[model samples]
Target: MNIDECESSPCQNDGTCLDKMNAYQCLCHKGVEGAMCEINRNECLSSPCKNNATCIDGYDHFSCVCLPGWEGELCDVNIDECFSHPCQNDATCVDGIDSHRCVCQPGVSGINCQQD
Candidate 1:
């Protein structure tokens, strides 16, 4: 009689064990790997976050948490600080990654170039 190799239940992590001639084969479940399905696949292994963002692992996916001055799914976009027209006195509003800068006209001052 042929010995049943799968009788010992060597597979792990809910894997299915199949008996072979003289060995056993383990069919791993989804999101798991290894000879015995002992390793759980890390959802955040690919580093999905961009621009110095944080990556959080989930059931079968990952979340990219944006950092300061960054936004979007992968945190690849820089925040547009000058979109609201913060500058005054006809000053030029320059958008930057961390903050916005106002290019004041001659004799103009203050954070938003409001003074003249």
Candidate 2:
């Protein structure tokens, strides 16, 4: 007389339960694990986000909250402030970590080389 151990749906988080010899096993689904698949896998464990960006975990996925002067899916891109042409008066723009430098063409002045 074998009592069905899987009679009761004890598995959680969409886990598959396999009845064994007076025991049961739960096969966790994607992005989940634990005795009953109750734990959500931490996608941020690997630090996928770049440049001090915050990592948000999701169902089998992750997202990055980029800091100022950064962009892209993984926050890997350094925002080019020069893209908007902040440097006026025809200055050479040099990209930096999180900022841009305007090399004023001779006789030009001001923070953005806007002055003459």
Candidate 3:
């Protein structure tokens, strides 16, 4: 009959019962959610992320963000679609951000110093 007693009563796994003056409320935990916190909530239904970004769900909330080389929800894969040759035949190699530059010798035109 008492709210405190009800809250302590054994309900079910992942179920937290909150007793009120006239009624009771259940705060469901992971893998469980609903009016009484007795139903299971499917995370896939929400499609929380946008632009193909990944959606990582958390307690009572969720997170959506894109990964490197990918910029959409679900983290849809994409192609970098780029190439570079930084090393010269006579000179050394030099790496750069998103691209590479060649250190040509005294008389080199292309990377790897193939031409003069």
How does each model score on TM-score? 0.69, 0.83, 0.35
- Candidate 2 residues 1-116, lDDT tens each? 66667789878888999998888899989999898888999999999999999999997789999999999999999988888888888898888777899999999999999888
What tens-digit string does per-residue lDDT give for candidate 3 at 9-70?
A: 54454577777776667777876677566565656568966555667765555666775555
The ten-residue window of minimal lDDT in model 2 covers: 1-10
lDDT of each: 0.88, 0.90, 0.59
Clashing pairs in 1: none
52-105: candidate 1 lDDT, tens digit per residue? 898987644678988789999899999999988999999999999879999999
Q: Candidate 2: where is the Cα deviation over 4 Å?
A: none
Ranking by TM-score: 2, 1, 3
Per-residue error for 24 in candidate 2, Å, reads 2.1
* Candidate 2 lDDT for residue 5: 76
- In candidate 1, stretches whose alpha carbon ends up further than 4 angstroms from where it belongs are 1-30, 34-38
lDDT of 2: 0.90
Model 3 Cα shift for residue 58 (angstroms): 10
Q: Provide the global lDDT of candidate 3 against the true structure.
A: 0.59
Candidate 1 local lDDT, residue 35: 92
Model 3 vs truth, CA RMSD? 7.4
